[model samples]
Target: MSLKPGNIVEGKVVNITKFGAFVEVEGKIGLLHISEISNSYVKDVSEYLKENDIVKVKIVSIGEDGKISLSIKQANLEEQKKSCKPEEVDWNSKKRKTNSIDFEDTLSKFLKESEEKFKDLKNYKNLKNGTYAKKKNR
Candidate 1:
């Protein structure tokens, strides 16, 4: 079977390295990079895959020199979609929750805190320039 970009196919892990694993798909070898092994961080490629292990992979790219790049994570699109559930909020509830502060209030609070910090900085600068007096030690 001909393999192209976005093609999902079954492959065997022929060889593994620190960087990635080589997969044999339909008599053709493809490189499954460590990053493409999973959506999460992969500290060890061997931990997730091993030699001769069968896995489904997606063809991410094909170089002119016949270097095929594959992705195990990208092949499982259904699994990724199933795991991600949209958060639903009840907008019609009569008892409106006021506990969560709105954006405008948060912005105003941040600006007030920023102004206080600027004032403190200005005072410190004045003290450093000898324009502001330091209290004498009794």
Candidate 2:
């Protein structure tokens, strides 16, 4: 079978190099780059996978030189998809506003916080400049 870009397939690790692993899938050999091997950190390919290991991989890209780039990460991501349903995202939900909420109170709260931060900064600067002195008890 002719392998195409973006097709998920099963492959065996025929060879492993420092840069990547050679996977033979359905009589078609592809390069599984180190970057595409796993979702999490993989310090060494041998530690994560070994020769003759069977793994499901996704065809991420195809170069003009007929180099098939496979991704184990993509395959793992596909597996994760099977466990969850696609969430119905309501884009219009962002536009919804409650009438009971007062905007002025939020604004005043933000302004009050800003004033307090500014006062603290001013006090720090004055202290650094030796303009602040301890008051003497009368």
Candidate 3:
């Protein structure tokens, strides 16, 4: 069967390399790149996939030379959207409101928070080192 972009297909992983994995789909071999493995950072491809594992992948591109690029992340995303209920609010659909604060007010708020954090750190260090009781007496 011919593969096209955005087509979801099931493939069995035949080989794996540091860069990507080769999957066999309908008697054809396709490359599932490591970066396309997941939406999240994939430090190790083997950790997420292995040889002989069947995976559902979306065909991202098919080159003139017949190099097929597949994405498991895209397929998973499509499946998740189909199975999950639509979100009530799409936060990304609307532009975020930026509350404009005066520079003076912003600086003062930052300074106040920083002072409180510094005091907490100092108190933590004193307590850890058994110096808090000494300071309390003074």
52-136 per-residue lDDT for model 3 (tens digits): 9999999999899998999999999999888999769876786645787778999999999999999999999978778767777
Residue 81 shift from truth in candidate 1, angstroms = 4.6
> Candidate 2: misplaced stretches above 4 Å?
86-138
TM-scores for every candidate against the unseen true structure:
0.58, 0.61, 0.61
Kindly list the per-residue Cα lDDT of model 2 for residues 30-118, writing each as its tens digit. Answer: 99988888777777988878999999999888889877889999988987888889889987775647675678998999999999999
For model 1, the superposed segments whose C-alpha errors exceed 4 Å read 78-138
Q: Clash number for model 2? A: 0
Q: Please write out the lDDT profile of model 1 over residues 41-65, one tens digit for every residue.
A: 9999999998999999999999999
- For model 1, the run of ten residues with the poorest summed lDDT: 129-138
List clashing residue pairs in candidate 2.
Answer: none
lDDT of 3 at 22: 97
**CA-lDDT, candidates in order:** 0.91, 0.86, 0.91
lDDT (C-alpha) at residue 133 in model 1:
48
